[model samples]
Target: MMISRLSAIATAPMRNGLSSASMTSAYAELHCHSNYSFLEGASHPDELVARARDLEMPALAITDRNGFYGAVKFFGAAQRAGIQPIVGTELTIDDGTTPPKDRVDYDRWGERLLLLVEDKLGYTSLCRLISMAQMPNAKGVARLPADQLAPLSGHLTALVADPKERLPFYQEIFGRDRVFIELHDHLAPDDRSRNQRLLELAGRYAAPLVITNEVFYATPDRHKLHDVLTAIRHRTTLDEAQRYLHPNAEHYLKSGAELRRVFDRYPRDIV
Candidate 1:
């Protein structure tokens, strides 16, 4: 299906009282990856949708890394389950920094940014950005230069994955209203420090903050399989993939109440 059509289906008004005002006030998962992310995501789009429905989430975005491969499926599933689907892609930006000397280093290169489509124009812009990143790049490495992203910033909202290092460029190109500073805490040891820094950046730039869970799987129990998938993507075994593996199994989708508990200080962002 065309992405625009799929997006239309996903964003259609909910049926069966699912669009009640109270429900609309709940948190929206804006940065989730599904299996289409190529082993990086553990659950199918339907599974994620079902879980979000059970949690009564108002909206969910299937932002598979670098592509909208799972969007059609996600849109259909959300339509069936009575939730709004937001279409987006998580793209890695090329800062024109030094090239990696080895595979491991390559993985560490490039900052990631989330681009969510607000309208048809944003959807088309997303397609162009993905094409630019993947068309001429080597396998497993897709990126677009920062300058290349400036002109195509219309109708799309950008979320800086890590505000500390990549905020300035996005702020300049997309402007404060179109850009959001993403705040996430996966229970990692340093997550507190990281979130604090992001808050500081948001204050400095006067940018709104949006909370995202960065979901890779539907539930915490799937973390082991997700780790194996990551190992496979890197062409290594779990033992050697330690550096690439998530430290804990906390990257699963969390309910609105759970999110409030974790981010009680940032009530404005959780919405």
Candidate 2:
């Protein structure tokens, strides 16, 4: 059923409400990863879709790190669950800045950006961009320089996360309406302050704000496995993963109502 639905959707010419803006669900999980993200994502695409179905979500995105490795699986699962599948990627752009040597896995190469396909054109552009980013670099290290994004910015919506300095740049490239400031709060001590700054930054460009939980797993119980994956990615033991591991089990797929409560202060950005 899943495969057939995906095949039919692929053969269809129209998007049929797959774009990010078309996601009318109370809350859309935009920044998500399945096990296709390698040592970082803890759950499979079907598992993630199952959770989204249980939570009554209408749409779910699989923005696996740097690629669409699980897009087929995600699309199939989502379609079978009667959910729209939004295709995207968590692209790491090289800013020509060095990260702290102490940091092992996260952000060691460059900045992270979310690019969602708005149409067939965007999907084509995304494929070209990912190929360019991966082909020139080492096998596992994928990074596209910041300057390379503008030409391929057409038909794609951009979402800026972390290191607010590049938010304005993306806004300029993708245009104010096409770019959004992503606000993620995982109950960390700095979440409030960081999100406050992000709000201020978005205000400067008149860019819209979107709430994303940055889900890496389908349920809270998978957090332990997530920790182990993080440890493996960093080539360290769980005991040594200390600061590298997420402080809480909050990076799991959340329901619309739960997301509403989490971002109650910013009710307007829930969707």
Candidate 3:
């Protein structure tokens, strides 16, 4: 049974709409963070790529927040490891209707959207979108309105995590086939309920579901550092930032077998 299961994992086709020419793994990590996400990410691009390669993952994405700061480094590492490199970003979109208290409040002003590039056209669109968000904002504050997506939605795939009301807009802009409902399970108490809600939304909209660990660090042992980084980002002590930190150490670069086990009931969502 073990051998058969592993074989199935090795041979299963990727269903996340990404090309699998050089990426043969059954599972590919689509949502990831590196140290370039500022204080929010705990691992370097090289370290993340090495961890993914060691786990036998055929491809890994560096979806750092707001920018592709670590993309060049990640691509280099993936090339050396002989794996496909997926470039994307966790874009924060604010409709510009509300005024934030301050420039630093950009983080609190917007909803986050995960975008993955599908081809050269997607890469060009991502660059333009990032520029549109950053050019008019303060140095560290970057957010774009939803109106910016329509022109750039052609070659990109979107993964929606929250604010279910925005899913329909994404479907309209990116097409239902390009918009996916993202599921993340950090093993927290609320994970089950949140994922259940997302599942229901997917069913209602007939959207595909994709599961990601939203990895911050390369391994479970790095959780402490991740916690420290979270505290730093919030400008608070560990005790004070407990509410913002991850509830457990499950956000690591998991292998195909480990991911299958984590989402066992929804195994088809691993892609």
Predictions: Cα RMSD each: 5.7, 6.1, 6.1
**What does candidate 2's lDDT look like per residue over 50-106, in tens digits?**
998988776778999889999988888888899988899999888787644444465
RMSD in angstroms between candidate 3 and the native structure over all alpha carbons = 6.1
Q: How close is candidate 2 to the true structure, as a TM-score?
A: 0.86
lDDT accuracy of residue 271 in candidate 1: 30
What TM-score would each prediction reach against the true structure? 0.85, 0.86, 0.86
Worst 10 residues of 2 by lDDT: 10-19
Error of 1 at 83 (Å): 0.9
lDDT of 3 by residue, 1-271 (tens): 0011111223222244212221334576778999999887789999999998887786778999889999999999998997778889999888545646544433456788988887788888998999998898778877888888898888887888895588889999998777877777777888878887877777788776666778889999999999998877767799998988888899987765676565554434432
Superposed model 2: Cα runs more than 4 Å off: 1-25, 98-104, 265-271
- Clash number for model 2? 0
lDDT of 1 by residue, 137-211 (tens): 776668888789988998788877575566777878877677877777887878878877766667677776666
| Ten-residue region with minimum lDDT total, candidate 3 | 1-10
| Residue 261 miss distance in model 1 (angstroms) | 1.3
